[model samples]
Target: MADETESGERGNVKTGGCLCGSVRYEVRGELRPVVNCHCSQCRKTHGHFIGYTSADRNDLVLAEESGLRWYQSSEKARRGFCHQCGASLFWEPTEGSSVAISAGTLDAPTGLKTVRHIFVAEKGDYYEIDDGLPQFPGTMRGHPLPEA
Candidate 1:
């Protein structure tokens, strides 16, 4: 990866934990720009549209996981959260080596920006996505990444 240096350490590193510190993690890799998912499952799980930033699974190290639990949210993916604090933390695709980390769970000054909105077709009717960022009617699977 271009972000890696001679020692194989990524140029960027970040740390975060759950509300109760039951699930702490160190991400020794580049974090993707944040993407907001408006899918119903995300809304239900997070009580609102959820923002996520991704990192390679290999680059993620769980510093503490005593209270971590995984929920198979769908046949394609699973969600991870802190059992003690009920803090949603991760979204991992069943077939991928990259995992999405809940942006809100990361420590402040993440140097990340919300780049796009996904699953807009299923977004709740009560609110409008007025930020004027790129909005996709569904997932970003086949779509181009928004210009940062």
Candidate 2:
């Protein structure tokens, strides 16, 4: 929805917070569509596949960050969470144009959809991805699924 910011410009502003409301954030402008990541690391961190939507780093504003904590999940990225409620919230790469936001943390009516699945090769064996969406064994950046 369009929101009026302090600058008086109407923008696509979305708000979300941690389970305890200790880590609130606002995103300005558009957000990327949701992408389900089934990587083992993501499953371990979120207890399942993690749905993420991304936005430019500059577009994310921390409205409240009293409980924000970061864990360096890998050499290339860090995970952001709320220490108070243990909400797994973000995945930010060491050098990237955008930061991934946990889809579940965003307030409802997000107007987003999960378009595809990534890291499918590492997905847990217990669940079947029956949604029929495109699946990639790894990232889509350079690896596209072979023609069926």
Among all candidates shown, the one with the greatest TM-score: 1
lDDT for each residue of candidate 1 in 30-128, tens digit (9 for 90 to 100): 888999999999999999999999999999999899999999999999999999999999999999799999998887667789999999999999999
Q: Evaluated with lDDT, which candidate comes out highest?
A: 1
| Model 1 vs. true fold: TM | 0.90
Worst 10 residues of 1 by lDDT: 1-10
Measured on C-alpha atoms, candidate 1 has an lDDT of 0.90
Q: How well is each residue in 1-148 modelled by candidate 2, as lDDT tens digits?
A: 5655544234568888799999989888678888899999999999999999989999999999999999999999999999999999999999978899999998876878888899999999999999999999989897543332
Candidate 2 least-lDDT 10 residues: 2-11
* Candidate 1 lDDT for residue 148: 45
Candidate 2: the clashing residue pairs are none
Per-model C-alpha RMSD: 4.7, 4.7
lDDT of each: 0.90, 0.88
